[model samples]
Target: MAVATGLKQEQVVAAAASDNALERLHALLTEDLRQVNALIISRMESPVPLIPQLAGYLIASGGKRLRPLLTLAAARLFGYQGDAHLLIATAVEFIHTATLLHDDVVDESDLRRGRESANSVWGNQASVLVGDFLFSRSFELMVETHSLEVLRILSRASAVIAEGEVLQLITSNDTATVEADYLRVIEGKTAELFAAACEVGAVIAGCDKQACAAMRDYGMALGMAFQIVDDVLDYSAVQAQLGKTVGDDFRAGKITMPILIAIAKGNEEERAFWNRTLERQEQEEGDLDHAIALLRQHDALDGAMDRAREWGERAIAALEHAPESVLKQALADVIAFCIERDY
Candidate 1:
């Protein structure tokens, strides 16, 4: 169950304290999310038992299951009561898992959720193959949904995700990657799937075009906030909570928000460090600290987080057409939590 992630009611309330109605909505959304998670696990395919080893390893790692939750919650908000929601929810989870499998490979990440990553435990080859398996499996499940419109949205989202991965790869280590470029990459990589999740839910509910569009906009804004926060975490979060070292992005040659902002504002010495560290991928013993200090000195991390909050507020505003209900309020709360949560 999605609830198996051990999301506490108190945590949700604390996460949503700024808005009372959202607390109630989060409670219901959590329950629906549990059902969606079960569906995802049950539908995941592993013809060879060994294949299941890595696939199950990652699937059972206790992610927040936000993507699937968004799908079910959006459908529920529109009064959908069909099993199609379950199928589509699983599809979303599969898509998300597939991305993670590939991401760990690309990032060479050793840890996730405080545990060894699948690539670390099972090997990169297995991780890549299992990731391919999940991607194909997601498409197969999408085909089973039988809604051409749903299929179209998911297919296009999948394509965009791949393109985003490629874009990030090309832009990696390039200090010239500005805010607009970073935004485009995250929108395609992260927000497109989110937008698709909400869109599919609205489609399943037969929602009007205006409401559907609203949900899409909400998802896009939420995802933008989500990615920005993730970038911030790379700089601000502790290793225990971040599940990685503070300067992991710089080590990986990825020019994230904090680094980009820092580069733009850095002086001659700081710019030289960035060039050698990122451009040359040569990190001396103290380079990480230097990068972190630069980010803090310029307030890039906090600035990016402020931008995330702004996007979260815009997301709440996009929900104006949504009915005044606890669920609507909770959707807004999730966006706020995305911006504020430590881990």
Candidate 2:
């Protein structure tokens, strides 16, 4: 199907090829991500030391660690040839972990990566406190880089991310929330960190402003695309791949693209069902299946998928301003993976 972004068939094929090449890029960066892991594990400490145990429990539970991997890939793409790549990579992971800790609390989530969430297992108090420790540790790692620009990039992202989380909290079940509002929230909460991840690499590599912006744009677009696809998967992916149930967003009262569009285009009876089941938060056992049917009726998932593809294309376009290298190719491949990945 042709998505609204109007990418050519070859572009889609190229994106698929890029997605396949991730195994090659993963092999290339295995050592770098491992170094980042070591640094991250070494720094998960506090004077009181309660943080060490709580943080360890969450961090040790395996995650893809994609944000830091993106940072490492960006540095490699620019031929950084320096040890700071690992430090910056660790910093990005710290930032990501901190957010996850906070996000579970905000979303009242029970499971993550097929296990109990930190907030569920360790309690919200420990999760919140440990998340603060990780954020502080991330700043410390940034200071080790001794680049004012890198610090600024991360600090601003952190602030924006906090704001995004707050915005989402306030907008829950708000039927008035539009697509643009959704974009703003995800751009701040999700994309800002991604932009900072790639931008920090350019700063570490001593790239000029233009190069830094290029990487930043690539990260932002990729992150946006990634979240949109994730929202779509909440409806489409099987429970095993998603590590969560279908209609999870509906339960959380967050109106994602598919839900929003479906609610808009559904028939009178369908709209009333959504108002009763979703807006009222009174979903019966069969409500999710009916909601899924509504999405199919409106073709909302396809629309959301198309929106994700547009963001992916924009992410690739952002790479045009970057210096061509294997690293850049790897980053491009990451963007492609964001769109094509089923989980």
Candidate 3:
């Protein structure tokens, strides 16, 4: 699959190697996407060389630009005209990138998109400060939109994303975390921006409240499914295919849904194993293999994927009231793409 713009062919192949619907969506929006990329490049410029260097490096890291793609797709689906969507799209991208930088620093992650992370290449301090710059730039882009709701929506998302990261920090190293707590973490860290991006697409399109609600619900649900699958992939995917080290979450003691499921169904010995590895963070080599085995034995991975499928279904249902178009179908296909990620 030649995924969206801004991805290398190899990365695309590794990810959605044969997803035709995703490719069609990318092809349909090619011209508008070109404009979005131009704005992103221009806005990233800074007098400070390190800021641009680090920012540009991560920005080009070629993960799915899914958030911005959703913003653009949503706007067009609602018949948005004018170039305002371009600015909003770029702002969404900046916000997402800033969070990735902050996340890598906090996670002490060495790899991103199958390459050395910015925090690894530059220092943590540099990565953190530069993330701050990009975050500030996001607000500047939002302010240019001149829509209070747009500002309100994205500003709130930015705040919630920070809170989510903090919440994940609080939940780390604790296997006792429940499913609801895990859901809250993903909502704040991952889904809030996704919801805002799509909701703002309606804002720019001048759509009514009903359409806006539909867009927000669609994005939130899709984002929820996306993050669940992402956590599952951390434990199940090839590290190179995923563009990050597999078991990173396990090493960091992050309490995700799979672990929660396994804990719910695991025997006493399995529970102790989880507590030692995830709760106490007393992990050693071969611990990850054992953890994977436990998850499989308990069928936690299947349960997690089932939960993801439910959310993906909810996302499609949310879009039912929207008008029919190729864009609408493409957006639906995007939900399928999110749920079906194997890379």
Candidate 4:
């Protein structure tokens, strides 16, 4: 399928293959990431076997470790020399993993990163408890940083992420949800953590207020673009490449950008279709296919992609005053990778 970005899926894949900005960033941060990984493994250990086992299942799962990487990269961009970024990065990953565990239970999802989700294998009770453990462990790591500012940033992000999840729950299955409500949900649940991750890096590095704000802006915009594109992919063939079930959002009756745009542009019949399948939760086998068709017919997917690109541009523009360096350029490239990645 052609993305709303005017690139065919094959073209998107080829472009991603050729440029591969994420790979470049990984190469730059190889040693730092290794230390972060080691710290993560050591911190996750506990006398309670289930805590480590369940947490390790998801932690060892094939995640990109993107959030923690952002923390490390942001610090390095300011020429930070301390090992504190390593601890902060590990703490960020724990927070993220904790959220994922809670999310799978809430979504009642069966798959995560293409495998059986922690909740699916370990059950909801175990998943929630382990998630709490991870959250507690994350705060412990944060306290070790000895920076009250870092604690405040990450703790506030944790609260905001919880708020965002609650907001999403409120909006889910409600076809009447507007674009603004959707943006609020994503900004709280998704963008806040990304913003905090980057901001914490700068805070620990003692960056000037202006520089700290710039990194925060870059992360927030990049996160918004990241999530918008992820929502778009739910109806795209590319979701399969990520080992996700296509139409999982539609199946769950979650009101995403494409659905919202389609409903706005749709005829009465189309609106009723949404009401029946989404609001009413009366999905039949072919409902997902028909929903995709409507999205295409109304150019809803294109509209959503357009919004994603707008956010991507904003992320890049936020870096205008950043010092020119290979790491800085790689960070900019990451914005494109977030928007254009096929898998």
Candidate 3 lDDT at 262 equals 94
Clashing residue pairs in candidate 2 are 77-327
- The number of residue pairs in model 4 that clash at the backbone is 0
The local lDDT score (0 to 100) that residue 202 gets in candidate 2 is 78
What's each prediction's TM-score? 0.90, 0.91, 0.93, 0.94
Ten residues in sequence with the least summed lDDT for candidate 4: 1-10
lDDT score, candidate 2, position 289? 82
lDDT for every model?
Answer: 0.80, 0.80, 0.87, 0.89
Best-performing candidate as measured by lDDT: 4
Best by TM-score: 4
Worst 10 residues of 1 by lDDT: 1-10
Candidate 4 residue lDDT tens string, 1-343: 2221111344334434545788766767777889999999899999999998999999999888889989998888787888999999999999999999999999999998889999999999999999999899899999999999999999999999999999999999999999999999999999999999999988888899999999999999999999999899989987877667899899999999999999999999889999999999999989999999999999999999999999999999988987676667778999999999876
- Across 1-343, the per-residue lDDT of candidate 3 in tens digits comes to 2233233455333334335666756766666678988888888899888998999999898767789988988887777767888899999999999999999999999988888999999989999999999899999998998899999999999999999999999999888899999999999999999999999998899999999999999999999999999989888856547456688889899999999999999889898998999889898899999999888998998899999999999999999988776677778888888887776
What lDDT is obtained when candidate 4 is compared to the true structure? 0.89
User: Using TM-score as the measure, what is the rank order of every candidate, best first?
Assistant: 4, 3, 2, 1
Give the candidates in order of lDDT, highest first: 4, 3, 1, 2
Determine the backbone clash count of candidate 3.
1
Tens-place lDDT per residue, model 2, 193-262, is 9889988987898888888998899899988998988888888856546566677788877878888898
